[model samples]
Target: TQLLEQSPQFLSIQEGENLTVYCNSSSVFSSLQWYRQEPGEGPVLLVTVVTGGEVKKLKRLTFQFGDARKDSSLHITAAQPGDTGLYLCAGLPSGAGSYQLTFGKGTKLSVIP
Candidate 1:
């Protein structure tokens, strides 16, 4: 099974709307990082929550960490075209054996003007 999964692979909405994206997994991680990427550019870090049941807010975006550290969610209030991008969640692995990350396929959000 995929360590992590994201729902609503694609989303399109008008300006000033609201939407939510979900991420799920069966494994645990030391931390989870959310990223946003614009066309032709690498993803930029949006937020990172390291604790179970953690919640962090950035502007109109709200991020939450699952109690088991195996799930997550992103809620966008008042969407705008400028908010269009790819939303990705990556796990920060720790301890022995590689410590590589597991990244969600990504949620493509398009907020039209």
Candidate 2:
């Protein structure tokens, strides 16, 4: 079974601070997606990275894919309390043939005011 490993499973930072979360795997994937989830609601898709070494920016957030397609990272600049939530990374394995996503354990972030 393919697995995604997320680092710093939990994070707490003051408002206006910056933070970064990472997702890694031993297996290669065809595509990878990042999502942000709030309590009592479904996850919201943030960005999807398919090409290796690709970088995408969504306002203060940045997403990057490793050259081998085996890892990804999310960087937040000047975080706010509104940014506090659960962050997840989902990947589609190259030969899975299925549209199902393999999700990482997730990183819980808290931005204090």
Candidate 3:
């Protein structure tokens, strides 16, 4: 099974801060997806980088795929209270039609206002 793990598991900071979250694995994936979710809502796709070494940015958020497609990272610059949410990365392994994502436990970000 393809596995993805996240570091820190949780983060807390005052408004107007900076932070980075990481996702790593020992296996290569066909595609990688980054999503941010509010407590009761489904994850919203931030970006999907299919090729290795791909980098995409959304507003103050940046997403990168590892050279070997075995890892990814999400960085939020100058985080705001609105950035508070659960951040997750989903890696699609080979032979997956519906590659149900193996999700990282989650990085619960709390931006204190």
For residue 32, give model 2's deviation from the true position in Å.
0.3
lDDT of 1: 0.90
TM-score to true structure, per model: 0.93, 0.97, 0.93
Weakest 10 consecutive residues, lDDT, candidate 1?
A: 92-101
Name the top TM-score candidate. 2
Q: What is candidate 1's lDDT per residue for 29-105, written digit by digit as tens?
A: 78899999999999999999999999999999999999988889999999988999999999876446736778999
Q: Taking the tens digit of each residue's C-alpha lDDT, what string does model 2 give over 1-113?
A: 77999988999999999999999999999999999999999999999999999999999999999999999999999999999999999999988465779999999999999
Clashes of 1: 0
Q: Root-mean-square deviation of each candidate, in angstroms?
A: 1.5, 0.9, 1.4
Report the lDDT of model 1 for residue 21.
Answer: 98
Better candidate by lDDT, 1 or 2: 2
Query: Which tens-of-lDDT digit does each residue in 1-113 have in candidate 3?
Result: 77899977999988888898999999888898888899889999889989899999999999999999999999899899999999989888856485577777789999999
Query: What local distance difference test score does each model get?
Result: 0.90, 0.96, 0.89
Q: Give the winner by lDDT: 1 or 3.
A: 1
